[model samples]
Target: MVIAIGFEGSANKLGIGIVDTKTNTILSNCRRTYVTPPGEGFLPRETAQHHKSKVLEVLKEALAEAKLSQDDIDVICYTKGPGMGGPLQVVAIVARTLALLWNKPIVGVNHCIGHIEMGRNVTKCENPTVLYVSGGNTQVIAYSRQRYRIFGETIDIAVGNCLDRFARVLKLSNDPSPGYNIEQMAKKGTKLMSIPYCVKGMDVSLSGILSYIESRAPGWLDQGECTPEDLCFSLQETVFAMLVETTERAMAHTGSNEVLIVGGVGCNLRLQEMMRLMCDERGATLYATDERYCIDNGAMIAVAGALEFETGQSTKLEDTFVTQRYRTDEVFISWRT
Candidate 1:
């Protein structure tokens, strides 16, 4: 069996996973998250430290759970880019060291492509218009001519980043995640307060909406004009609407009947419901994976990297570098026909 090991430390979470490509099965997935205090965001230096401290333990767990020895690993893969520089560098260094120590070939997988490939593998959705939403990236993608083409994207801050900032404003708990807390609060919201909906043709702008909400949220709560629940509710409705609308448009443009949502924010039930409604209206199918696959994890990197390796793709030690601004469409989708 062709076994691949992947390392991921793009953001706050550090994950390692083993995948058996010949059977399309995940052998093991292990992770550790660097969660900050309420109203605080994780800094790159500290996050990288967390990864450095936990990386070995996580790797050991992954190997033990997979019941595999180092000799059984056919290749090593690491997330190459589209993530925080410090965290990405930590993972790259670990992956590089392991690759050399084990005398195995190494591959650098794009972070966005990892999410897309994992979503497809878990959901079994073929050729769907993908709506990838997360803290660092946002885009509507569809495959064509061996490329995941970007049809729409954020012109400003990402939707998840907007939510995270708002969560800080409200001093929400970061135990699980800021966005999950927002979704829970939104469920209790009875009123839909006015929030700006900024959609620029195919692209969406979220910074303005976040600014408007952040400016009014304090006054709204102090004056009893609205509750935190209401604010969360209004924010979700407005932003998710923009996402759904753009995804629908992409579906129409691509003539695709399938819609797949990936990335952290895509785990929100409200967003899934909104997209499902839209898909129903258009007689299309909505495909989504739960938190396990939606959240950043090493399994995704393994899956994507294994695909590239099986198709004769490998990155030399000198070429294994990371970038924070890797775009979704930049990589050539070699495995896809």
Candidate 2:
């Protein structure tokens, strides 16, 4: 059995996880999130600092939880791209250091593929349409020609970024998360205001919607035209509908009957409910995980990296660098047929 440990700090969350590739089982998954105060968003510099400070602690906790040592770990994995540069660097440096110290082979993984692999493994879905929604990414993908082809994606800001910026406008708490707080308030909302729905072809646009909402938020609140809850509800309904629309289009095009949602925003219950409804309508199965696997975590990286390693893929020490713009479709799928 090959045991792989993964390091992930692509964004605000820093996580370490150990997985056994033979059994497709996660031995340990640990994480720490950097949360800003209400009305504030996390800057890349501050987020990177947070990861640097907490990386060792989280790594130790994961190893202890897994009851494993360097001797037992056969491979080490780290997210290499498609994230904030500083945060990615912090994790990459740590991963490199660990690999050198332990004298083990290392694999650099793509963050999005990490999520896709973990989602498929956890849900046991053979070939499903993937809706990967996160703070920095939003895309509808499917496997084709040994690559995860992107059928649809946001042309402007990502859906999670839109929600987060909107939360800042409302001065929502970032304690647990801005998206989570918005979801709670939306549940209490009784009215749905008219919000713009922008889905162009296979791509969706969310920046304009956020801008439109921001411009009218003060006026709507001051005039008592709508409550915060109502606005949140409207925003969720509109954006999620756009997402569902594009996802369905991809499903139709691919003729896929399974849908798997991944990433931080995938933790939203409302999003899941909408996707579930769409799946039910089309007789497709909807597969998703809770915060553990949904939000960014180390296990996903370990799982993906393990797959890469098993397929005879390993990053040379010279190529262990991180990038901020690694596209999911750029990675060659050596393990997948």
Candidate 3:
């Protein structure tokens, strides 16, 4: 059995997974959310420190659950970039150290590529336009010419970040993620308050909506006019609609009949429904992965690393630096034959 260990410390979550690459099966996976107190924005150094403290614990748990020894693992894999520098450094240090100690080959996989790979694995779609939405990113992409091309993306704040900001504005619970809480509240509300929907040539602007909602919250609460649920529902509707529009446009432009939604935001059932409805109207298929693969996890990293390894992609020690803004197109395909 070809065993590969994957590590992910891209955001507030630290994830580790063991996989049997020969069988394309996930042997074990474990994740732990880093604690970020309210009122403070995401701090790269603090986030990395959190990862440093918890990564070993999570990795050990995953290994124990998989019933595998460290020697059983043949290779190490990790997310390389498009994330906070401090958090990325924590994972990179661990991966590089492990690679040196174990005398194993290391692959640095792109985080966005991992998302797309996991989506493809779950959906089994050969050629599908992907809608990748999350706390740090929002993009409409498609695979072409041996690379995933970004057709449309957010120009300002990411959809999840916008939601989280709004959640903070409303003093919503941060536990279980602010986005998930908003989703739950949206399900409870009925009144649909109108919100601005901005989409410009496949690009989206979320900061405006976030600001608008924050400005309107006091009047709505003081008048006891609209419930929080209604606000959540309207916010979701406006944001998700823009995402759907960009994705549909990408599909039309690329001539892809299938649409696959990936990333943390994709876990929202309401968003899934909106995409599904759009796909149905267009006579196209829509695919979404479960929470395990949708959220940032080690399994996807392992899977993507396996693909890169098979294609002969390996990272050099000197070239192994963390990037806070790594783009998907910047990666060279060393594995594709």
Candidate 4:
């Protein structure tokens, strides 16, 4: 059986995973996230250093958990692009070193493709319009003509980044995740305050909304105009509504009934419920991975890279470079017919 080991250190999260090529099952998944204090964001340089220090330990744990020797792996896979430069580079260097050390073939996988492939694997959703949402990315995509065509996306910052920044403005906890805490707080919200709802055609602009909310939030809280819970509720409702509308539009354009949500923010029950409502109204189905697979993790990378390797896709040492601006459509989907 073909087995592949994947390393993912795209941002603050460092993941090491192993997967079975034939069964498409994850054998082991180990991960660590570099979390900053409340009201702070992680720096790329520091996050890179953290991953550098932790990758080896994480790799050992993953191998032990999987109960497999390095020699049992057929290939090594690493996330190559569309992530923080420093973190991506650290993983690339480590992956290349492992490739040479283990005498194994190396494959580079797109981070976004990793999420999509993993979402498909666990959900068994075939030919669905995928809504990929995370701290660094937000896009509505559909597979067509050998590629995942992006129909709509955030024109400015990603949806998760917007939420994270907003949560920081409110000094929310960053232990599990800012988004998760915000979701819980929003549940206690009874009042739905007014907020910016910006959706321009297929793309959404979140910076303006974030600015507007941040500016009004302080005054509202001081004047007893709105509580933090209310603000969180309004923010989630507005942003998630915009996302659902865009995804529904993409599904209409592609004439697809299935919608798959992936990435860290995809774990939000509020967002999932909103998507479910729209899908139900349209007589469609909604698919999403649980928090474990939904968030950034090595399992996603392993799944995508294993498929790439199984289909004879491998990267030479010289080409195993990481990039920060790789677009989703730039990748060729060779594993699928």
Which candidate leads in lDDT?
2
Instruction: Report the poorest 10 consecutive residues by lDDT, candidate 1.
Output: 1-10
Each candidate structure's TM-score, on Cα atoms with residue i matched to residue i, is: 0.99, 0.99, 0.96, 0.99
Deviation in Å, model 2, residue 169 alpha carbon: 0.9
lDDT string for model 3 (223-312, tens) is: 998998889989999999999999999988988899999999999999999999999999999999888889999988888887788776
**C-alpha displacement of 174 in model 1, angstroms?**
0.5
Per-prediction count of colliding residue pairs? 0, 0, 1, 0
Decoy 2 TM-score against native: 0.99
Q: Over all chains combined, what TM-score does candidate 1 have?
A: 0.99
Angstrom error at residue 34, model 2: 0.4
Local accuracy by lDDT, each model: 0.94, 0.95, 0.87, 0.93
Model 3: how far residue 185 lies from native, Å: 0.1
**CA RMSD of each candidate after superposition:** 0.6, 0.7, 1.5, 0.8
Model 1: clashing residue pairs?
none
Q: Candidate 2: deviation at residue 84, Å? A: 0.3
